[model samples]
Target: MKSRDFTKTGPVAMVAHACVLVVVVCLLGAAVSHAATDEADSPLTVYVAVGVLDVDEISSADQRFTINYFAQFRWVDSRLAHDGPGTIRRDITDITAPRFLILNQQKVWSSLLNVVDITPEGEAVFRQRLWGDFSQPLRLHDFPFDKHTFELPMVSFGGLEQQVIMAPDPQRSSLIADNLSVADWRILGYQTEVREIPLTNDVSVQGFVFSFEAERIFTHYVVKYIIPLFLIVMMSWVVFWIDPTEAGSQLSVAVTATLTLIAYHIALAGKLPDIPYLTRMDLFLFCSTLLVFVALVEVVLTSRLARSDRVELARQYDFYSRMVFPAAYLAAAAWALL
Candidate 1:
């Protein structure tokens, strides 16, 4: 048996052998390790874990309200957790919280800045406690019987929608404390949602919006403004019962009612915020004022008729005015309130 030496092999054969060796070595290198290091990896996206909100309290006075809002935020950097931080957590301790707002005041929201915690898995926890006055463009057109939906959004300041996303908690959408104190405004339940709002710079960002629906307790408004106005209008109606033969007495009552109604309307107007359009209350007041003025005119006309020696005609006209005036007032009220 003769053994062949590789050195004695032909040049072409040796070249082919070397090529096979090179291929095997390259494949092994790829299988064993990657060229890039762990530190070289950068995070492109941050996913916020589902969170819970604990609302402390809510109180409102017509336009704006005070809220003690608290929430917890969990942010995960999965890529960083797997590589940069193996078993231990990363901490970026700072005094500032991550957000800006469109609906709340900067001064008040600044105080809402909270603490952060980063776990071993690159999970950042943000604990927030905020107390501030939030304003809504109240559609008080249906005031006292109005239902309102108000939004409180915690918006991301610099994070773009592509870079960061907010995930609403499946377990908890909104958690409101029982016995929330709002005297005139009834505190109904709320809903939580994840939203993307457009920024001035043409980019959009993610946020958590908590919407609260509330109903105004009608009894208070009825007691404060509506009943008083009704009483005054009734006082004016007293002229209808007065003798048409006494012109001095009739004029005195009419003048007194007119002045009193004008004063009531002015005072009530002062209580409301300056709105450009008419409200349900405004329409009612208008109808009431018109009725009172018409009543005063009726007194004037009837007294004139009596002085002209048509006493029976004056009495009949006065009787019709009372019925027609009240009926029209009632109809106008239905149109406005209903």
Candidate 2:
């Protein structure tokens, strides 16, 4: 009877041990599956928001002028599925699809808009939210205000390979294709206007200002290329002061200067956007060219006078060119600035 009891207990113990092993294996399998799904669903992303105010037409009576602009974002459903092992791998692709909302506020002029008001308005335009995949970590910060903002994300991609798309305005008639990638992004360095348009009449005039902090490259171009070019052409008029016997040499110099200006224009053509209206750069080039042509004409007239022995008249030509050319150039610049 005792042997029968022992034999029954052994079978019962074995069965219990087998059941525990089965439960452990099932739990391990479920944990692995959950981790795999999480990995497949994670990805990184970037977003941008923009705002503009038109203040071109304002009356003196309207003292409370201001425009407020901001942006928010929503997740758009994407067809692409995220399937990757690393957190960076999964999130990097999502950076291509950015989403955001924009808010614009306009008010009558309360007082003259100062530089501080303008600075904040510009800063609000570039705030963005960035997120990482798998880890689901999020980062929120102000977008790089410098020209190099476009190139900052390239560090993650091994080499610079990023694209930029401009947000559109529903209310405006003009459609601007601001979309650009790495190759075209570099051209922004050549852009002169940080904020191209002010508040206009069709839209209520707002006192708010949006301006770009000029980059080093842009500053360098203005000081080194644009300013120096203008100065050189203006100085060419001094050639009129040289002896009329040297008039032929002066003419050659004027012609060569004009040609050099043309070459500069051609070199910059690819850097600028194709637009119907003239840019500030174009205006500068045009004025410089005109001055050079005027110098050429003055030289021709002086040469004729010298041949007739009217040396005094030839010298008078130099005096007028020195005074007239510079004054005219200053007037044109003032008008353009206004």
Off by over 4 Å in 2: 1-217
Please identify model 1 stretches exceeding 4 Å from their true place. 1-62, 78-102, 106-113, 159-162, 171-173, 198-204
User: Candidate 2 local accuracy as lDDT?
Assistant: 0.44
TM-score of 1: 0.75
Best prediction by TM-score: 1
Q: Across residues 1-338, which tens digit of lDDT does each residue of candidate 1 receive?
A: 89989999999999999999999999888765453333224323323332223333333334666666666665555433444343443333332224434455332453443445555676666655666677666777886578888777666554322244555655344566666656666667677777876555787667767777878788977888888877877778778878799888888887887898888778776556877878888898888888888888888898899989998999998787778777787799889878
Residue 203's lDDT in candidate 1? 78
1-338: candidate 2 lDDT, tens digit per residue: 44455445787787887898998998898888877555345542322223322212211112111222232211222323233232121232233433222122233222222111112111111232221111111111111112321111111122113222232233322211233221212223221111222225554211112222112134545665677777678667767768876777878777777788778778666544454556555666677778788888888888888889998888898888888988888776654422
The Cα local distance difference test for each model comes to 0.66, 0.44
Best by lDDT: 1
